[model samples]
Target: MKTVEQLLQAKGHKVISIAPEKSVFDAMQSMAEYNTGALLVMRDDELVGILTERDFSRKSYLLNKPVKDIQVKEIMTRHVAYVGLNDTNENCMALITELRIRHLPVIDKDKVIGILSIGDLVKDVISEHQFVIEQLERYIYDTPEI
Candidate 1:
C-alpha cells in the first residue's frame, strides 16, 4: 500500500543516468561501477530512454558489433515505462508484471526522481507481510482466552 513517494523516501532517490550519445561500453562501465542493472538515458535534462542489461545482451547480438562501438541510444529501449510519486507499490508491481519490465523510473513534477526495480517491490511486499504477521501474532498473544 506504500506509495512510490514513501518508498523513495525510504530507499533514497539515487538514479544513475547516462547520456544517449555515450557508448554502450561507457554505460556498462557505469553500471558495473554502481552495481546497477539499468541506467536512464538522458538527453540533456530530458529522459529519452533506458538502457538495461537485457537490452545490451539482446540488441548487441543483433548488431554483432563491439559494445565500445555501439551507442547507448542505438540499443537502449526507447519506449520507456515510468511511474509517478503517487503510484502505489502494488500498482507498480502490477504494471511491471504486465509489461514484463524489471525497472521503472519514477517521475514527479515533470522531473525524474527515482527508479524502482522488481527487487524493490518484492522486498516491500515481503516487509509489509511480515509486519502484518507480527501484528496478528501480537494481538493473539495479548488477548487472553478468546
Candidate 2:
C-alpha cells in the first residue's frame, strides 16, 4: 500500500531526462552515465516521451542510419504511461505488467516529479512482503495459548 510519493521519498526524486531533439547516441550515453535503462524525454520541463533501452534496441538498432543520425523523439515511446503521487505501488506494478513497460514517469499537479522502474516497484513489493512476514512471525510467537 505504499504510495508513489513514499517510494520516491525512499528512492530519491532524481529524474534523469534528455531532450527529445537529442541524438539517440546522446541518449544512450546519458543512460550509461546514469546507470539507468530509461530516460524521460523532456522538452523544456514538459514530458513529451520516454527513451528506453528497448526503444533503442528495437527502433534504433534496426535502422540503417547511425545512432547519432536518429533523434530521441524518432524512437522514444510517445504514448507514455505515468503514475501520480497518490498512486499505490500495486497499481504501478499492474500498469507496468499490463503495458509491458519498464518505466513510468511520476507526475503531480501537472508536473513531472520522478520516475519509477520495474525494478523499483519489484523491490518495494518485496520489502513490503518481508515486513508483513516478519510481523506475522512476531505475532505468532508472542501469542499465548488459552
**The best candidate in terms of TM-score:** 1
lDDT of each: 0.94, 0.94
Counting only residues 3 or more apart in sequence or on different chains, how many pairs clash (N, Cα, C under 3 Å) in candidate 2? 0
Q: What tens-digit string does per-residue lDDT give for candidate 1 at 1-146?
A: 99999999999999999999899999999999999999999987789999999999889879888889999999999999999999999999999999999999999887999999999999999999999999999999999993
Q: Candidate 2, after superposition: displacement of residue 26 in Å? A: 0.8
Q: Tell me the lDDT of model 1 at 76.
A: 95
Using Cα atoms with residue i matched to residue i, what is each candidate's TM-score against the true structure? 0.97, 0.95
In model 1, which runs have C-alpha deviations exceeding 4 angstroms? none
Residue 58 displacement in candidate 1 (angstroms): 0.5
